[model samples]
Target: MSQKRVLITGAAGFLGSHLCDKFVSEGYFVIGMDNFITGDSKNIAHLTGNSNFRFIEHDVTNYINIEGDLDYILHFASPASPIDYLKIPIQTLKVGSLGTHNCLGLARSKGARMLIASTSEVYGDPLVHPQTEDYYGNVNTIGPRGVYDEAKRFQEAITMAYHRFHGLETRIVRIFNTYGPRMRLNDGRVIPAFMGQALRGEDLTVFGDGSQTRSFCYVSDQVDGIYKLLLSDYTNPINIGNPHEISIKDFAEEIIQLTGTDQKVIYQDLPIDDPMQRQPDITRAKDILGWEPKVGRAEGMKKTFEYFKSLTEEELYKSEHKDFTNYHK
Candidate 1:
């Protein structure tokens, strides 16, 4: 059999870049497409010369026309960070709605199996802990964060429509908080936020009382689970994340220790609709995909710290002082 051809949208972003690398190493022809809206080209710069890897500057919200037989499509294009989505609300909605539509259509036309990257945010501010895939989320549609949350919800709905109505092979993996190398220092996710602050010897900002909890999954483990889901026949949404929970305050303290920063812990008002607690129940992922996160938080944090430490002072400063005012514009 010929080597499989895989198309990954948002191919320049954190998870997408890693996915491209994995496919290339596995001897698959990888087509990575991104608009550079939230993704940076530098993330995939190393792969520019690889034979099995190709990059396209395209936005998934627009129609896609590609040559050759596509064996699989991974629709992961969207502004995933809260700051990013809030900065470009319209773009967020479009990527989740129109972009997903285009990818599903392409999958149908090419007879390729597809997987949509959904999020644990689809659960909104969960009323349940250790959220199972079956739990209906408690989302606020009118809130500031609604654009991202609802867009993901709609993406899942339409993806399932294609699967049921069109009989297209489809998979959905609802990712929880994930962090590791390649995560933008200014992405505004908790891990990056804390790490950036500690690296700069600045006060660690903890939103709200810092009692809220979240589970963090290492990026490699997240990519591994995604690959498993894509190769499997599972049609339902599988929760992919580490179940080890930590309070926001403790997470901050851990970062301070790791960075050896004496920075103070500062409390800020929680952003609108921030999930108070998020921990995935990955029973389905384990039983079906036979996947579980292997990297412990301490080890993952050490690797991430090393990556951040390698940045130049200018790069480090930008990561630490990212402006959020124009995020939506």
Candidate 2:
């Protein structure tokens, strides 16, 4: 059989870089694309000389032009973290809408299968426990978090519309809280923020009385599930995440122990529209793709902590928020 070529947007980001590695190792020509707005070059630096990989530095919000026959497109080009989306809300909306459109157009033109990176945020502050695909989320469209939540929701709607009206081969994965190597230390997410604090010997911050819960899937397991969903016959959305849940307060304790730190946990006001509970119902993934997370939280957290510990003192002390003024379309 001939080799397959896949284009992965957001290829320099945490999950995107891992996906690029997976495709290349599977013997496919991988085209890695990113605008570097939130993605770091170091994430994909290792793939520079690989014959199976090529990098394109471009924003997906504009028209995308690929030179050859493409077999698949994974639309993962969005500012995924709270600090990122909040800082660049307009860009986030544009990427989810315009970026997704360009990718869909490219996929249809090339007769390539397409997969979009949706998020558990689509179920925004869900009323249901252990959110399933069928649950319609309770989201505040005008709230601070709405930029990202609505973007993904609109992303899902457009993807499904294309699938039904145009008969396009489309897949969507509702990714939950994922943590692992390459996660920005200063990103406002709980994992990186907590770990960064621990590494620097600062008190871990817990928002909203620390009762809010999150389920974090290791990056490797998340990539595996996405890979399976992309190749499966099912065209509908599937939740890819670890259903293992933990409250923020408890999770803070876990991190303190893991880092062997002497810092204590400090409570803070929760950000507006932050989800009180976040967990995925992976029943569909299990039945359809035969996929489920294998890495336990302890094992995964340890591995991730080690990665953060290896960072230089400069990286550990970088500002709490990234400066995005230099990024342009």
Give the TM-score comparing model 2 with the true structure, all chains together.
Answer: 0.98
TM-score (all chains, Cα) for each model: 0.97, 0.98
**Model 1 clashing residue pairs (backbone):** 87-327, 87-328
What does the lDDT read for residue 52 in candidate 2? Answer: 95
**Best lDDT among the predictions, by candidate number:** 2
lDDT of 1 at 191: 89
Per-residue alpha-carbon lDDT of candidate 2 for residues 166-269, written as tens digits (9 for 90 to 100): 99999999999998999998788889999999998899999889999999999999999999999999998999999999999999999998988999998988
Give residue 319's lDDT in candidate 1 (0 to 100).
39
Across 35-84, the per-residue lDDT of candidate 1 in tens digits comes to: 88888899899998898988999988778998999999999899898768
